[model samples]
Target: MTNFPNPDENHASARAGWEHIFRGGDIPPRYRSLAEPNPQVVEWADTLPAGGLLLDVGCGVGRHVVYLGGRGFRIAGIDISPTGIRMSQEISAQRQIPFEGHVSPMTALPWPAITFDGALSTSAIHHQRRADLVQALAEVWRVLKPGAVFIADFPSTDTLDYQDMRTRVAAGQLTEVEPNTFVDESTSPDPMEDLFLPHHYCDAADLRDLLRHFEIVRLQADLRPVTTAQGSGKVGKWVVWARRPMTT
Candidate 1:
């Protein structure tokens, strides 16, 4: 059996680490590249009703909020890091893109039930442990209207980082909090790579199990080459397009 950190401790640690990273304002170049809207998200969102209200879960720095808002969507974003929310608001202001932003965790969205017409998350929900991920998805479900379109991405276990972390955990160099969940303890001169937090990886089976409540429209790997200041490699992500059921 694998040992896991106390749930409360794990959550607190992740929140603090992200807060520190965002507060430093030295975001890595790789992350900076993410300021642009994801093409897949844009394509999926194009199907949404024009000018409909949308919610962005874990909207780090509001990349999607700003981009989608500019495209004429009424968008709001939420993140656990106050600095992230503040920076997103500042950027939106600078660009004159009107959007709402709030500081909160994905597991506990501040919005009322069925308040959004559509919702999305990118590269964010996988930051939690399995249980927390479930709660966060439930919160997303709670806020979305019946039959609302929802899309999100999860880190794939096939990624090089996941393989490296598996090797490290086997060598006892890193702790495996759960089956595919790990506490990132590796050090890096690059502040971007220095994030110390829990990273959860998933596969197709995991996604199917986790999203059983939704009507899955698409489930496929989002493969792309990524170059960072430290090195270059490919990242494999499981991008899922799902819809909230029309009832219950």
Candidate 2:
């Protein structure tokens, strides 16, 4: 918290740092499984049709971007961190994955309506607050074509494992630098550190409520077992699946 920007500015820095870490392969061990396809990824991979636009939100290090691009889907990604975007770009180049990465927030994507055929976001939504979440969902709606698939997974209030991380960090044990704080407004950028939004943790029921805008094709909670690295607790991880409705 030293030499930190304003809360708003600090927030942006937090995001930027994550982007840098994502590219640098410095992702906290708790979140560094870019290779292992999570359950949400499994569902997304199964639903993705061949040769269509796939938007990879929060594309850390471009792992999925490279994979999906190789699968014949045109790809693009958005992330709050510049380092992440840069890393994705480098990885894309090194692996010959044809895709673009935008260093910006998903709430204000630089794309037009019906821009994608399929979309995926795994283990990265809790970084947004409720308002940001709604904005992000709206952006998804705006960019996704009718009947296109959209998948996302995030933390819920029931996700006490993350809470343990914070407690342990305070006690000087966990490797995580800090517990991302939820705030009223977005944070600003700091050259040294990044800011993030651990804004909302919607339970299954709560997610259902916010997902009213979408068709909500399906929903899953606590599907994966929480590892000791993630947290030593009974609460498991959560994920959700949804679809944009076809226009009548």
Candidate 3:
């Protein structure tokens, strides 16, 4: 755990670094997006019926936007960090993708309720405090249209990777240098990561409670094999797929 108490406002640089490191291979870039979306999210999306507005919440570099846009889907992305927004904009300009990348907190979406046809957020939610996370989910529920599907990825405290982190912290090899932030990967020689970000770990039960409003379609606890700096292990992250009820 970080020595500093969790900060109210997470640093934008951390999120920006997450984006850069992801491209260079650490955790997937989109993980900071509000959920640990399963890696094959795009495959599942390809199978689903097309022709819907796709909302990428907490979108960092706008990878989702570019991917969906390439498939001819109307996509929009939103994030809290100015650095993230700039990175996304630069890419959007280069690609000439029709996307609106905005610097906005996911908790307060600028769009109207029941506006989107479907949405997906990659690993962006861990940054929020529990209370705020609940409210954010509630807001997302409100904005989703009936029959709209929402998918998000989140980290689990139960993972071996997390356990390793705790062990390191307990041993004093790593220390929380700042609130809601830790300094392990930061000290490493790789420029991809300067330090690890503070993540709010959620168990399966925690997720079920947080997203009670939506009818869950699928939930993965140990999403895939545990991936770390060394190599892959047994279990790592998880993803949740759900839908707002057609009626409510």
Candidate 4:
């Protein structure tokens, strides 16, 4: 998510960082698995009626798009990288999966209101600044049909790694330009370059505020082990599955 170039010039540094990261041709193994829909995502999507329109926000290289579109879902994907969008389009064509891919920022999605029956913003969202995150979530809420489902994940502040990061920031070992937001720099000898990108980690209160427009069905922390260039440890991730209230 941090890899997305911010539309505003104030985030020029962040944009440069992201552009450099995406310039690499190597596709991480973790992302390769995304070429197929996650079982959890499939389970959630199955609940929707047939012919539902689904969106893949921050869809890098169109993995989810190919998987979901091949299954007959009318799929659309958006990403900040032109290469990602191009790759996505190429993959969709190769797989013969009908899809539309756009190069756009998640904060400013180019879609009409109530346009999607379901949406998935996976492994994204955390890259945004506070205001951008707010805008992105609002856009998600706006584009989703009433009673539609949306699932997303972001980093969580309720973790040891978060505390460690904060401690480093407190000691001036790293920079926190915005509250709970980190900029590019790491204490690790060989930090995961991407980890240094701008990231906003949130707490439960933050999640509640972000999801206020929707009826939250599930909100939980995913404690998964991850290693940065600095060290190896577990970081908590926040997963939210929610629905737009029918009355709204």
Candidate 5:
């Protein structure tokens, strides 16, 4: 088994980085552009039972919560960053949409078992080492109802950042604390890019092993163009739609 940073250490670094980003006055345009609901999320959400209770894990700023809540789905969200949760609440309030938000890490959700009909996460979850990722997935599983759908995206090994990290690790310039996991140390002008957070990239086999408990509905690679202070490029991710088994 690969050794990883202590869970508390990891969570503390992540929380501080994210809180700083959220508390800072306007987020980067790259993130601001994501205000719209992801098309893939919209498609899957449409198939869920009407007005189903949903949980948005790592729902920074509550974009999905507000959007889905407006569509009549009862939605709650959780994030490790308190500032992010505050911003989410403020956004929901300004829109007059009811949103249940909490400050919590994914590895230990504050909800009860079988509390959510479905769950979704985006641009999150991959920020942990493998062990924490597993714990977080188990928490999601524990809180979801049987047959509940889950939609999430993970950074792919093909991403430029991952490739660069691999090269640096090989050159002994950086450490791969765990397989395909590296602490980002970019010096880009974008605060989001310079947060020095851990990022784990996964391949198909990795995803399969990570999601073995769920019945996968769809798994595919998605590449989307993005512009950042560093430059413009495509971001690669593996998007998955999975369902919990009705029977244990």
Candidate 6:
């Protein structure tokens, strides 16, 4: 059997990042977006049969989970952060919403094959290295029933922030160990310990190649507003909605 890294081991940085942001409480207003679900997800959900099961991969704080659950869909959410899962559970309970929350990496989901009718991964998958990102996408594909739809948003290489990062790499401020991969360091006011995490940026062509197995429904350029930490202007992302073919 292949040994998958436990959340505390290989995924420590991701878990720590989210735990620090959430701090075991209500999700910050900027991150809490239950009132407005992703438009693509909303459109796909409308077409699902009654009582469809939807999986929210990298579901931080259960924002989408709660919203979809309240809409009568059976919801299941998974995230690498224990704190995130806890917060999601607490909020769901407080809101009287029913859903399953699991603390696990997207690369290795703790579920059987073809378990969900739909899946949504927003602003999440890009956190991993390319290998892990591929594994996560394959896992997502594996868990969805044939003809099911999946929507995801990933950072694009065309973003201004990415260009700036490249310039910094040239100046040796940050390191790029692999193509389109960066070893991110905290640029905080005070000195901080390094997480040694790998962040990957993808272009539209890369995504098309990676997801060649699925029929592409729509792929559009999305601009994500960044906080001061991420620098000025909006970074780019590719939001894709695709469906698995009914037959292999």
* lDDT (CA) per prediction: 0.81, 0.68, 0.68, 0.77, 0.83, 0.78
Q: lDDT tens string, model 1, 22-71? A: 76666554433336688788898889999899999888777787788888
Off by over 4 Å in 6: 1-9, 24-29, 32-35, 186-197, 223-235
lDDT of 4: 0.77
Query: Candidate 3's residue-wise lDDT over 1-248, tens digit each?
Result: 73533334444544555555544455544333423334656755775567677788877766677677767777777877666777777777788877777777677787889988778887676655565577778878888889888888887766666666566677875554432223554445335433455456677788898889999988887556657786665565667888999985
Q: Is candidate 3 or candidate 4 better by lDDT?
A: 4
The TM-score of candidate 4 is 0.84
Task: Tell me each candidate's RMSD, in Å, in order.
Answer: 3.4, 6.1, 5.4, 4.7, 3.5, 4.7
Candidate 4, residues 1-248: lDDT per residue as tens digits? 56653457534544454455455534244443445566568778778778789999888767688778877899998888776777788888888888888878887788999999999987767786788888888999999999999998878886766877788788877688778987646444223336556678988898999889999998978787777876777776888898999986
Q: Which has the higher TM-score value, candidate number 2 or candidate number 6?
A: 6
List TM-scores for all candidates, in order: 0.87, 0.75, 0.74, 0.84, 0.88, 0.83
Answer with 3 or 5, whichever has the higher lDDT: 5
Residue 2, candidate 6: Cα error in Å is 20
User: Using lDDT as the measure, which candidate wins?
Assistant: 5
* Model 2 weakest lDDT span, ten residues long: 184-193
Off by over 4 Å in 1: 1-7, 25-27, 32-34, 185-190, 224-234
Model 1 poorest ten-residue lDDT run: 186-195
Better of 1 and 2 by lDDT: 1
Taking the tens digit of each residue's C-alpha lDDT, what string does model 6 give over 6-25? Answer: 54454877777666655633
| Candidate 3 CA-lDDT value | 0.68
